[model samples]
Target: MPPAHSTRPAIAFAVAAFGIGTFSLMDAAMKDLALAIGAYNAVLWRNGLGSLLTGVLFLGTRQRIPMLAVLKLHLWRSFIVALMAVSFFWSLTVLPLAEAIGLSFIAPVIALYLAAVLLGETIGREAIIASIAGLGGVAIILVGKFSGDYSDESLWGAAAVLFSAVVFAYNLILARQQAQQAGPIEIAFFQNLFTAAILALAAPWFFSMDATGEIPMIAAAAGLAIISLLLLSWAYARAEAQVLIPVEYTAFVWAALCGWAFFDEPVTLTTMAGTALIVGGSLVAARAKPKLVEHTEITTA
Candidate 1:
């Protein structure tokens, strides 16, 4: 008889997939909220609310506060998260949700290169090919956008999203380092606290009370983010990171569907073409043998 296969990894993969779906819904909520309020305000309030939820969990769980070293790492990661969130939310204001999401799919490819440079992983032929395809896909999308009647604002929005993707890649690298030192709950708590603190400086100028009715949406976004973070953390803890990485690509499909259903944004040919390359490239890069170094936990909270 064939040996019984372990169900643990399969269960973890399923949870991770569900987490990705929840994250997509959170993105849709944030896009709507960002359109209602300014991106800065939306980000500020979301992080603030997220901090509250995480703080409650942190306190209730009685996790030890991080040491100075861990706290420093947390702060830096939080700053990157703040930047990534603001840029992505800003991009959503001007870019169609599907197109923006398609462009952001280059992040895993970027992460592969970052892993090589920062973590000293070997960049194999597959990674090189994947990088080329991902970059070419991004170029095609950018050319299409610029060829049309794109406004300067739209150009800036595109730039912001691209920049966010780069930062997010680095954030993934940092997450690996972080996973060794802290639990997901502690990480989420400090991430929100630090993100809110960083954005608080601009809150006075960008804050708004007019969108009070949208508070539920903002809270829901926070809730979804926290849940996704916890689910991903749990999965990463149980299974190899390589096994879970493919689950990340499912976000593209969710984004495409949500963009159509919620915002009435049709998936264009350019988006379809670009997303194909990005997803194909990411899968190629993911095939590279992951180094035996610590597994990087993904968190968007």
Candidate 2:
């Protein structure tokens, strides 16, 4: 059997943080693409390139065909995640990257309650507290952001992100099942391929020729996404969930830096305070989750 837990928590933590960094960087790339050609078009193109990239890596491994149930789970997740990514990427077009990510911290907490309802898991105290704190964070963010003079687009962007987070929380449930049945490359491979297929159905209405000019950026985003996935998967496989989950919060830092450097967006004090409650709540939920659930988050942002 593979090494089930990391021998060094410190190194594993760093690796996990690096993984989040790559993922955040990829998000910044996607934001640029979204700004150029719309989020739907940008994500659609990224998935197409991602499918080709991951397909090559997956085929190289020469793995056997997955079971039918695994394939079904993969397809289902692709559909859900397609919705999630498009909406969230659209949010990035209007919201500050750090603020958007801070709002997304609620996804895992939402997943906790979802597990309780769908999987029949008991609603423990930590899970309850996590939900409350996560909502509190969201409240702080909405109140702060909305209090400012802003366009309707920004308002819609925040709503879009929360909607995406709901879909993402459900995706987390499916991710746990899929993780039990597939490796990271296989999961990435099918998600990219099938999500593109699912979204391609809308090509007639939403597709843009402008996307052709953005191929290089889209390909770079896909490459960064795969690297992030591999790093997170490797670290998660070797470390306890509680050990690595906190590193997910590092996305805020990366998002902040990327937002500042790339887009000149400022991170506000309200975003920081709200992120604290959200991350604090998620930490509680992570501690309460069964060790087996470590793999569940491997597929997420």
For candidate 2, the TM-score is: 0.81
Query: Which run of 10 residues does model 2 get worst, by summed lDDT?
Result: 292-301
Per-model tally of clashing residue pairs: 0, 1
Candidate lDDT values, in order? 0.75, 0.77
Estimated TM-score for each candidate: 0.81, 0.81
| RMSD of each candidate relative to the true structure | 5.6, 4.6
lDDT of 2 by residue, 1-301 (tens): 2223323545555776788899999999999999999998998899999999999988898755677777888899999989999999999988888779877876766676676677565666765776677678767865776675878898899899999988977886676456555777888899899999999999999999888998889999999988987776566554444345445555776787899899988767887787788678656655553433333222211
Candidate 1 per-residue C-alpha lDDT over 1-301 given as tens digits, one digit per residue, 9 for 90 to 100: 1222222655666788788889999899999999999788888888899999999999998777667888999999989988999999999999887678757767767776676687565666765776676667656655664565778888898899889988887887786567656778988889888999999988678778886888999899889988988777666555444445545666776788899999997766776776677567656644555433343323223
- Stretches of candidate 1 off by over 4 Å are 1-17, 124-147, 235-248, 273-301
Question: Number of clashes in model 1?
Answer: 0
